[model samples]
Target: MTKRSSRLDDAARAGWLYYVAGNTQDQIAVKLGVSRQSAQRLVSLARSEGLVRVQIDHPIANCLELADALRDRFKLKFVDVVPTDPGSESTITGVAESASAEMERWLRREQPVLIAVGTGRTLKAAVELLPRMDCRQHRVVSLTGNIAPDGSAAYYNVVFTMSDSVNVRSFPMPLPVIATTSSEREMLHAQAMIRPTLALADKAEVTFVGIGDFSNDAPLYVDGFITAAELKALQKAGAVGEIVGWSFDSEGKMIRDITNDRVASAPIPPRETSLVIAAAKGPRKLPGIRGAIHGGLINALITDEDTAAKLLG
Candidate 1:
């Protein structure tokens, strides 16, 4: 083999060992008989040269049909449905894999695009699976604050992850997920540090958000952003789902109740101008996903086959 092709082979091997086997750079260097820096460069070369691709390539017929039907029903801009493992009721892995596929498409674009992201467990999973790339042309901004209720940054926030994964410019909202009161929320929103990020989020052409269900294990409540009294109050007002802390009722109407009055999340972009894509699934999020679709909080969806079927049903 030529020297160039031999180098490509080494790079590919390095990538497989690092990404697939979850090996550290030192481990890869030891296995490949190369210096640690060389191993890291080899892995980066593999990804940049297109020798590494991580995706769920299967296009099951039922999933296709469901995706098509969902797109038609909601007038969505895009949709991808993947098969879920029979053993798993929640398809977090499958949804994350599919979301990473779509996110990669945007990250590969040459022209600059403003991409906004919301925080959640599934979104965090998606960012973790993304193959590292150099996409400094695009900008990523967060729709929700990175701060959790307990004063620590929320571990599930995806903006920092996206920045690290793609080497893109990232704007993170350093405020709390939700303020303790409407006046406190206003004060945070007025802060100069976070307003630009929120404004940029409003103009982002592509948005990645997570649909949160108002269930017994609701993310906001579980994360301590909302109290039990707040939860019961919102449910009493017909709230069923939330996107970026903005709660909505089952009929897909944004509720202007207690939690929403104090939410610090950026406003959902206009659906006509932006592609608000979300990755969500499982029985818990079914109501919220459906509500998001109906209310125009999101215009695109990436989910599992079973979830899609139930959404259409």
Candidate 2:
């Protein structure tokens, strides 16, 4: 190698060794007989000249554009995009984990009531990765009714898990999300026992929800909350996706239907709360995800890279 190429190669090797070996600049510099600043500068030069080739195996591409598209379309304050690597569960898990880290940073600000909507496998993944919420005065509310039997072990378990994580109270809605008839819904809402929780939902400061597909395999259907007939009806009615059971069209516009009315009645309006949705998956969720962006229901989003690329494209 020529003199220039030889020095560049040494710098490239040194930089790779430092990065992979988890050594600090100082350590690399001392070991290489150079100043820490010189080591840092050389690493940059190596990278710029393609002397150092770093392979990051990202699952998805255009994550930044996806984040920008989501923010622009939804008018959100922030959007986190994670890469999708179908072959790697660990990569998928890392995306979810990174989203949780970003959420932690956002929550550091003063927000009164943080609402969590229960729907979809992605939401579950995000929640599992969510760091322990440790603000005593702040509260976390359940955005939707539980899918399990009322007061059942599973219901309480989910509620307690969320409550304990934030070290705050859970505004539990102790009622079925969907009722047989409008009259039944009215009666349930009239009851003193369920009124307080519902009221708290109405006053939520921040809401976290998941978007859903109309497929039977969708998270809501698998949760045992909706029947196959309901899913079919939603699809027939041109419903592309749903949030907290409220169906919307491909543009995220609310589809005026009995089911939608029921869903809207069950939860507070997005306009009245700081709405955030944990969005993920690709192609499958695009219609519903796009609907959310159009409907002004979601003001913040946490999503994976593959889904982001689709949205931006």
Candidate 3:
């Protein structure tokens, strides 16, 4: 036999023994009557020569099962469940990483798409984790106001982060999250610059947002976006959660209160967007997440395994 053919046969044998038979290098060396170094070289040759190809089947069976269950139960278009420790902070981090990956995938699509984003901690975290990419073809628009009462950009604003990360043009709603009154909100929405951005949001192919719970410890309240009295009023109005700064009741129906009218962001119906992805995870967020799902506010979700189980329950 030719020398080259003999080497190929030895490589195949070493690869089968090491990979398929699950034998150690030492065992392969002894069984093949070769040194350990030679056995290792043969396996490497097998890989390089395409005699053996390694395929890593990710052991994400549990996560896939949960994701499938969530999709089926909520009739959602997509669902991703990430593993995490037994805590809200860890859960948030896990979900953010997963959501970031999902966003990267969408941004990499060949067809240019508009992405509408909302403000909140979880969404902000996801944007922070997003890898830098030059996706100038895709445009990003804010689904909520960028400014705060103190004349500073809202802490959780996603426009700047997304724009910088993707190096894309962004349309920010240059307004407060909540105007002083419904009339003022109307005036702000009427501005030519603001109107165009809001209009673009309505046409967004995908929307990413963080669901906010109505509890006392809610991020909105803790972040000083809303007063204690305002929070109490929302709770009294049966508010369970919010999406894109629009408060909704336990059934996910928009709560028509002063706050709703004063909200500066244009409200896009959940079903109108091709994809509404929400990044959130925690015990406190359970009710809001559930309400959002039931209300069809979000067709896709990125959350941790613990939250997924609670949601299934």
Candidate 4:
């Protein structure tokens, strides 16, 4: 390497050590076998010469076109595309990777309220990718809840995981999503504990939700929210998939079934930035996903190539 280029490299290295590595000038000097003053000078040189540039590493080219297409088609604020290999583990892994990056961005942004929803494995994977956040001014609230006794309430994990990521306020629903009768639901809604979170959902600035399929193996179904009998009923009713707990058909029209009515009944009035970040793959989700898109429930989406192609198709 040239003499000037070598100096630039040394300066850049020392600058990175001081900033990203959390090293003091003296510490950097010790590590680099230089005096503290020299370390300081190098840092200054790196900055002055523009050798230190902060780059957000994202799969722009591969993901951007698809992202733009979704955004334009669905009026989404943003979309993330994961171009995975055609088969095998590509779908889940790619979606997970993109979600991790997206979650990091969401946590970093200064937002007032984040309303979350429950639906599928892809959402679960995205929730798993969230790191513990430490922001104090933000609030995270669940958009819906589980109803059946066997339902695992995976949305609780979404709340817990997101709360850990940012040291912000968290609101969790402590009731079944649906009651056996309207009277029972009315009583639960009257409870003070549930009312506050319901109020929070009304004021949500952004919402993160996953889409759901009507199949028996759907994540929500497997999580015990939907029983085998219920699956059959939904299938017979021509129910396709769900968005924020609201089930619909192939064209995204609301099914108005009992189970779906439970979710649509949330107290919250949807926010203007009511973003539904749906992440899923496969032909099975096409109807449900397209329905969500057609219904205008999702203002944002993040998914893999296969899923995106299917949706576009």
Q: Pick the candidate with the highest lDDT.
A: 1
Clashing pairs in 2: 82-305, 252-291
> Largest TM-score belongs to which candidate?
1
28-141 per-residue lDDT for model 4 (tens digits): 899888899999999999777645544356556756777778778777777888775665753366665566566666667775556454534565566666655676666677
Which candidate order results from sorting by TM-score in descending order?
Answer: 1, 3, 4, 2
lDDT of 2 at 201: 68
Misplaced by over 4 Å in model 1 are 1-53
Q: What TM-score, to 2 decimals, does candidate 4 have? A: 0.73
True-vs-predicted CA distance for residue 261, candidate 2, Å: 3.8
Total clashing residue pairs per candidate? 0, 2, 0, 10
Sort all candidates by lDDT, best to worst: 1, 3, 4, 2
Candidate 1, run of 10 with poorest lDDT: 49-58
Worst 10 residues of 2 by lDDT: 149-158
At residue 114, give the lDDT of candidate 1.
Answer: 90
The lDDT of each candidate is: 0.87, 0.64, 0.83, 0.67
lDDT for each residue of candidate 2 in 1-313, tens digit (9 for 90 to 100): 5998878876886778676787788888888888989888877776665444343456344677787777886678768777667765432354445544554555566665455554445555555555566766566666566645344433322345555455665666666666666677788788997777667666666566667787657655676556778778778878888777777888777777647655523463455455565555566777787777777777777767767767766
Q: What is the lDDT of candidate 4?
A: 0.67
Which ten residues in a row are the worst by lDDT in model 4? 262-271
Predicted structure 2: lDDT: 0.64
